[model samples]
Target: MRVPVSSKIGVSNPYRSWKSATDPSPGNYSMGVDPNGGQQIVIWGKEGRRWRSGQWNLQFFIGIPYMSNNVSSFHGFKISLPDETGTMYITYKPPTQDLFRFVISWEGKERQLKWDDDKKKWLPLQSEPDPDNKCELYNYCGNYATCDRSNSRRICNCLEGFKPKFKDQWDQENWSAGCERKIQLQCQSTNRTSRENGKPDGFKKLKCTKLPDLATLLPSEENTEACGKRCLENCQCKAYAFVTGIRCMVWTGDLIDMQHFQQFQQAGNFLFFYRLHHSELDGGRKISNLVIVIICVVVASFLVASLWLLWRYKKKVKVSSMPCCKDKDVAIFDVSKSKRKEFSADLSGPSDILIDENQDNGPELPIFNFGVVAAATKNFYEGNKLGQGGFGAVYKGELPGGKEIAVKRLSGNSGQGLEEFKTEIILIARLQHRNLVRLLGCSIQGEEKLLIYEYMPNKSLDNLLFDATKKAELGWRSRLDIIEGIARGLLYLHRDSRLRIIHRDLKASNILLDAEMNPKISDFGMARMFQGNQNEANTVRVVGTYGYMSPEYAMEGLFSVKSDVYSFGVLLLEIVSGQRNTTFRSSDHTSLLSYAWRLWSEDKAMDLVDPSIRDTCSPNEVLKCIHIGMLCVQDSAVHRPTMAAVVLLLESETPTLPMPTKPTYTFLRSAIEEEYIGDAQEIVSSNDLTVTLQY
Candidate 1:
């Protein structure tokens, strides 16, 4: 339902939730636009202020780091400035969405839940005051301090240039007194900052942390650098943060309810600058990370030198002592004669991928130098950026031989770590398939890691499949070809390959398209390999997109070949309908799977075909594909057909297909669908324009 939210003084109609799921009565919590100030939503509890949906900086609330990168922008949230009557309103209207509502949970957790028609339940979408994150509570850490849930010992810690006001209480686990300044500011003292060559007070830079509350927008300072100057001139300004889509915000009053959230995607990161005395800032200069890197290098070099010298000295002494044995006909044997070996290179990109003993497994993956890659991509210019994800950006480049390549660069702040980088190179190098994306090589220089792949001119399938106009280019034949290619590719990985592999992340975006529009499965970072007859494996860490993940994999961390089949089914239905399975909803169905099943069971499977495809697609083939998709998405893993069988059915029309049972898709069993809602949890939908089309 599209409802109007206003912050008018007299007629503000806020959505105050019930006491619990079962109890439908006025509760102690409420949620609505911030009537006090700013374009934000506030969740109020009985104790007064609870949590806030950080200021809306045109893109998304600064409160949610994930939203800082436009992760929530696709949800179609729009807010209008105060009108002539001094009233503002915000609305939620995605082009295609289901019935959803806002509610303050019994525990004062502001939640956004979507209605699931099939299950007759409300699926949670967004929530504030995350019960798991204790720092979300209003002013929990007090003023001048930050909370870090990741810190196992203590949640609250004083910011730099400050110390706990009451040391006795603080040691006893009480930080209620907050913190006190360690040194007087330049403006606060008659003889200020004598300790650091009379340097002025400076700001301590903090990255990817929640900016404190009660920020006053500074429209005068347009440039971020100018914003810092403006803050320095003002004695009242305690902290400052520059939000991309919004004006610079300076906190003049006490900074409250700050938190140190985990490092986010590059685009999603925001820097918070807290005021500090010059002495604490090393002679009032910006803290250089390069200095830290250099210091570590020096220490490491010293240690290496010491160890080498010690080894050489000991070897020389041993040699001098073994003079008599050397003449006694000594025989030596090589210790490096073993055939089977494993590469143990870490944080070095594709250098970890070693060649197999047998030549049939193919040559070792090529390792491109960083200089070559940087030059090819024009020094990694913004214009050359093909796309940006949690792992930095993808650049389109060309080699000296005129071969085009797609380079995936890893961001230091990215969620993709060394394990994922190694996994991609090791897994892709060992497997070979026409329908699988080829890993040309990689570049590892210093902290920079990049993976080079055969460039796909058409990019990802989602580019065409989701766009209204671009989708027209994907005719029925092209869509069918993509489907068949993906099926055969999955078949090769699951059965024909030397190692039985499961492409955990099998979504439209992961399926790349070449010049011919043929689909090749890409991105094996989250993939798992099964050894001789090992059907499945369980892990505590579950990775993959939520809508496409199988029930067992998403809930119990249990994954196998069947998990890929389930993902394949989701992709199949999406391809047929030209709609996102995650957001698609019908009058009587919660998702595309149930909707298609309902139509199939009623002998009206032809209705499920995308209108664009209906004119050109053969009725029999479309129906058969729908039948196979339903079979692949069955409730149980055993009910789904293997990739081998799926390939046979797609390739051969003569083979009779089995009748599909009713398919039931479930949401994430965990309370938090995914703790970190990075690029993985979101659909990568690129828009031609930034304008929000108001309805």
Candidate 2:
């Protein structure tokens, strides 16, 4: 195989497959990075992680014993995380090349073997050191302890300030009983009186450290001082390490796998564990004035350069302005006059798309010259389009001034007429919040009515929550943030805004995602404005995404703030489960709601959690979210708490959730159509399946 020398395939597998007719079966053993990022390579069997090579030092795999034999040779490899985006490869150029290759035995043994031409059989060059016992498995020694390899039998000894967690487990060779603190650190308020433990049992250092589990990749700017301070602040933090390239990797909770190494070549860079409160970091005094000095020097240089630039620019302008003045003035006058003529006002908020000359609003919302908008959006090109919805197509447009804004071009034939268009403009123009999307004014020239808003970079929540690849990126923390953000936005709509607004259409698609994945509630064309203590209202035109619509609103046109709550509940479940309420299907259940309810009833709600979340996500926390979601989608409007309550519940650890009754109507579309009449007056009639109110 003439593969290029430059090209490499990263293979973490410890074993190689058999190539000849003599060996008929595939290799059983494989080696790869520990999923926990413990700097350990696990030798895995068909069923489970069989044994680990303790953890790596800078030079060698720590758990495996070094060979001092003259015939034996070993080479170890280590690379910084940044260099390892591709697969790992190894090319061994030994002094003697006698048809040697790496192979994994059928029964899961890893070895390097040579072909014996005379014997016509494969001969073993090296086999894994410990042949027969489970005790050879790495980390078999409990934490704060080291396995004494000097003796025929491995002996375990505790490091300073450590003792076994379970004495019985340790005596029985169940070494994973690990180690517990000799004196517990008092983190809780009730443990304040336990001062006899000596100022929260400080850390005892191991000279040559194999860093602990789950090392979080810290930002590059973080230094030793900040890392130390961070580690000290968290009571759970067991140890902290500050390396030159790796920077900070803090370990919290248990320190599982610790081992000793002799004759360290690259044992790892310096690691610090909290032994006791050492003298506070003195590096702050050294770093303070350096940044200020740099800023001052840069500012002085900029100011001096700016004066010279201004003088040159003035001379250039003086030469250019004379000839162009008359031509520019005439052009300006004509353009100004045309602009003045184009400036017409209408009561229906500023129209960027169409100009209503009769109405009295400034220039009828500054309708974009179609040519300018066309050029900006590359002739309404598909590439420039942000997304499309029931109202119209939203395009990503760059103005003449190079300012980017999202232009929502309302569909002319959309079910929502000019009334809804005007309402959105008026409502958005009057409202301003960091959480809410900012309305950057509108355009109305002739038929085109374009409303402009700040462009959110991440598109919409639907793109993320429902996408398999994207959903993995939005882990539990991000999901929780999105949930909290939506809650805040809803709170603004319902209570904080000048008018109490009910976002009649509150689906995942309508929720825009900011660059940071923060959720911004959008699509207000269908949002109803409530005035002066109006708690509930009914609309004949029941408009919203079908799956998200509350039973009261979908079958009957009675939609209130409570209806919005129901939609939010659906959104909440979708966010947590990474499954769409509408598209989800099951053999036994009709919809996501029924499936979730069944899971909740069966006490298997955790099963609904996405499998992609391999990180530390609390099961109780997920169940609590499910409980809150169920509460929000309750059949009775009165039973559901307001957005305010939802926000509080999401934030509080122990929220007193009300017992959610079964929803009044199942999301069986066929069943709903047969039972509920599709009439404006019929919708207005309150029944067990509906809630009715007159607008």
Candidate 3:
């Protein structure tokens, strides 16, 4: 006979606390799934939610990323969607021989227990909301602060450019007051328009961060670059972050619940905040005046001393010289003095020399002798040649140890001279990343300058990406991976590395693929380092590849991280469509950018995908990439996403993407032809048909 309960049976809340084992009355604490249907298990205090298991993502809960891997073997735990009964449930099948149980203690700690037969007692296997990880505590560090587990002394600290709001409270270990910006944002002031006229506020990049809370989702039509511009334009915007799954997330007021992770942990998110230029931040007016004063004084003293010395030297020279014309002697003396002055200036500023070979100083990098490089490359034989660029020809070489290497030998007539060669050695040698090409060593003898790198068996991305025969080998997955890899490398250069670098010539050819088909960014001859919050710089000599150059960079000689983003965008489009941006000419459009804009506007974006990979590629993923690529190639540098955002967009399965505005169709056939002619004459003659346009 079945015993029937008098009352209707309902699901018991684990969060509900019991006064005692004998007392059936419930206490204040209660635990249950979130009623908002967010797929998170939450424990509630008398007031509100005390703690929550992060949002579930079908496979595992995101907050505890390692949960699935750790618990799968012991208990096959799974969350089931609502069925016809309209009831969502979580279930787990225990191992046949082992016994286990779940429990919520009086203190609101949730744990899984396993029976140990030998001990004849229950053992706690795992616990939710681990107290040791302070991040698990809600708003543990308060607003505008990030909790870092790696920091043993203090887990909480304000974000860059921020300071404690209540100094006394902070010192007393009370972080509830949070922090505030040390300097008020220029855009927030009444004289914002006038202040912005001189130098607009820019973003300070923060890497490896957990995004803050209460982020407003930007419009679907906005890219990360546009998102930044929008935030800068608005006085209310405090900080912004862009991730793959979550598009553009801008925080107004105070940023909350942020965290920083160690290098080994997964910290892919990047945060940017509006701030005055580095000069302005540190009392620019006073500093500038003082610097100018000191420089003028030094210059005046040097000039006076030089003139006196020159007069004495001339008198001595006249005494020692044979009878000659006074004017002729004076001219000869002036020419010799000028030559000496130039040589002295060169010695004073040794930007090109990482190490002085003549001084017997140990080089920052290994120096391969000219003879060794020549022998390895078979005496620069044509058969051993790998590729050629504006710098020079790269040849495949094998060392005595059977180690393969790629040697880049600069041509005598190459536009990239000793300056660029030294730049490559200095920059590439210091930079270490999986996505970046490894610089083995260098060789400099007489007029010969060579940069040795780890040999890439697959060669450059263009070798396969553009070639119809080899394009098939790069399936949709491989192509996507390649794009992501390139993005990560750029991100490293722009944000992660010790030095902030802008790869002025980021293109398909510069992207070399390793044996595993992994893309490694090569060729740093054109790269520039930004020191101490210096984001953008200008040069009279504009040097970069033609099609990849951003509008501001190509036209006005202004280059920054965004310039690289524009080139990456162009490369992304090229990879997707299997066409060169400069050479692509169709009946409907003059260049690939124009053609893509047309297709995107007409809602025929899929048509832009290479037909070869259409069958294998995910339509959504391809469309997203196309949209992201268009965003990157936009006319305004301010409207392009950073490399960090690009990496997230490519890697994350973020459903929604910002709509791409009509990219500037600036590719003129005559202009392209003119640039091509100029490049061909000025740069190295290459069979690859690529040109580095220098204005």
Candidate 4:
């Protein structure tokens, strides 16, 4: 019977080396520090059979190609060697020390063992020598067949375009003879073009493989495309593949040891052969990949130019499509009577009335190619996706000049479609401010509509405040800068810009964070254009997100610039407290605003500040922001301060703010369903015009 106990060393289970056979003395094979470096593990053996396990490679054992499962999986497996006077000792940092052990059993079995929590006993994890024997050994199939570990029945097979060199030997389970080519062809015959008149012999695709070694790595100095080109140029370079992490690898020598992963572990490379002419390779359809590449590049360029033109066309269409609202004072131009001249010197004048109506004397906005955007975004791979929203997914991209860009691909299914796209472009093109996201260009390729904007490396403010690990980065200084920047942006929209516009949607997600953590308001898909004299409008149909909308706007579809003020107040509170307005729920409080109000009334307003930001924040500054947040979110639209006043209070050290009235944070949509108020709108025109709200 075996007795078990635990010792303290690297979090793994520790034990002393067992005694030797002849004299019952302790054995030399033990886990200890290396003489050259104290941080390595060296396995000592009798006489001179010492095997160097090598130093810790930060992630795994250096000498072993088979990475430690624990280390590779990053389950907190670490090895440490402590320096002492007598000798250095080794230890591990696993979840539990009792779970691991290195044992030199009495029967000559030297293995790293682990106490399986599920099995409840010491189990052999891995041995010094791999358990596979005979065919399982490396290069077992005589350089032709592979020994698959996952397969139920062990078998051997030759690579494509080849057959067993010695069939009798292989059938007898002695596969040393390897494989031979099925057909005998000279170098000239291999290139079908040489034999005929420039043609490909053929190609075969192999799949689910560990791949062959040495002979596969293409000679160093070759670019991926060039390497592939070189392989095709030569008859001997049979097959090739451009690996994901690794570049191109080609085979010149005889192919061997090819295996297929069961549908489960499917992982293999392709292997092509050179034995036909150009037309013969791919049913005569396979043009030289080089030619295909050239064609693709030309096509891409044409497409980019076409997309740019299409974007221009769509912009023109959007301008012409603006409907004449039933307003007595506004003069509507008759497109049918107008003579249209070409915007560009080369193109002829517009032939259609709709096209003629869009003609304007204003400067043309820049347009980008859909192909360029696609290349920048790596074809919009899921890994490059930044975030999703009502509009569409935002993808991070880098332009040719190392300029990063955020491409917003509008959704086909969005409720607010072409109107929003055109509105953002028209509004952003005419404005320039530090607090606003700059629109670089736009692309309209078929049904795909993409808007390119200055990339924000830090993403939205919501990402930081919502993440437990990242929230700390939003310190008092950064948070305050964001608040001020947002205020400046609103001030520009409300009073400083050429157009008196209202950013009807002003939540944390809409505020993009740049590399310096500076805030830039983005996603103007739902923004509204207010005439210089217009103050408020009423409608039956209403649209906007909850928690940040004013009461009248949320309930009766009555929206004014005050709606934005209320939303700004919600944003300010979220910034100060580092919490979301929508997801905020408390058993004691009805909403985030209510919670803050309760805290303020109870003389415990400091409790509302995020614990992450509390350390560096000043009590007075935070209290001031809280006070301003309450003032802006006050129930009455008349009571809320203009963005101009809000900016002043935020920047100044002294301001005697009026006490806030009870806020109408929650709007009674009806007696049945109550929607928390927030600023939201749906654009319906290209002139920064929002749609009439209709529930």
How high is each candidate's TM-score? 0.47, 0.48, 0.50, 0.47
Candidate 2 overall Cα lDDT vs. reference?
0.62
Residue-by-residue lDDT tens digits, candidate 4, 372-460:
68878998988999998877799998765466889999878765577667667667766777788888777767889888888888999
Tens digits of per-residue lDDT, candidate 1, 1-695, equal 33344545632437786754456678768876663324667778767778877777666776776565555544577766667876556776764567866677765776667898999999876543356577877778788898888899889999888899889557645576798888888666765345345667789888767777777887777867988999998988888877776668899888888878766536545678888877788565555899989989999999999788766654222121123334322211111112112222233334322323221222256566576677778889888888876667999987654668899998888777777877787788777777999887876678898899889899999989998889889987688889999999999999898767888889998999987787999988777766655788887667767678787776677889999999999999899989877666455555677778778889998788888877656666777788889888887999899998998898775569888766544322221223324323443222111111111
Each candidate's lDDT (Cα)? 0.73, 0.62, 0.69, 0.63
Predicted model with the maximum TM-score: 3
For model 1, which pairs clash?
none
- Pairing residues by index, what is the TM-score of model 2? 0.48
Single out the weakest 10-residue window by summed lDDT for candidate 1.
331-340
Candidate 3 residue 305 C-alpha distance from true site, Å: 50
Whose lDDT is higher: candidate 1's or candidate 4's? 1
**Residue 397, candidate 2: alpha-carbon lDDT:** 77
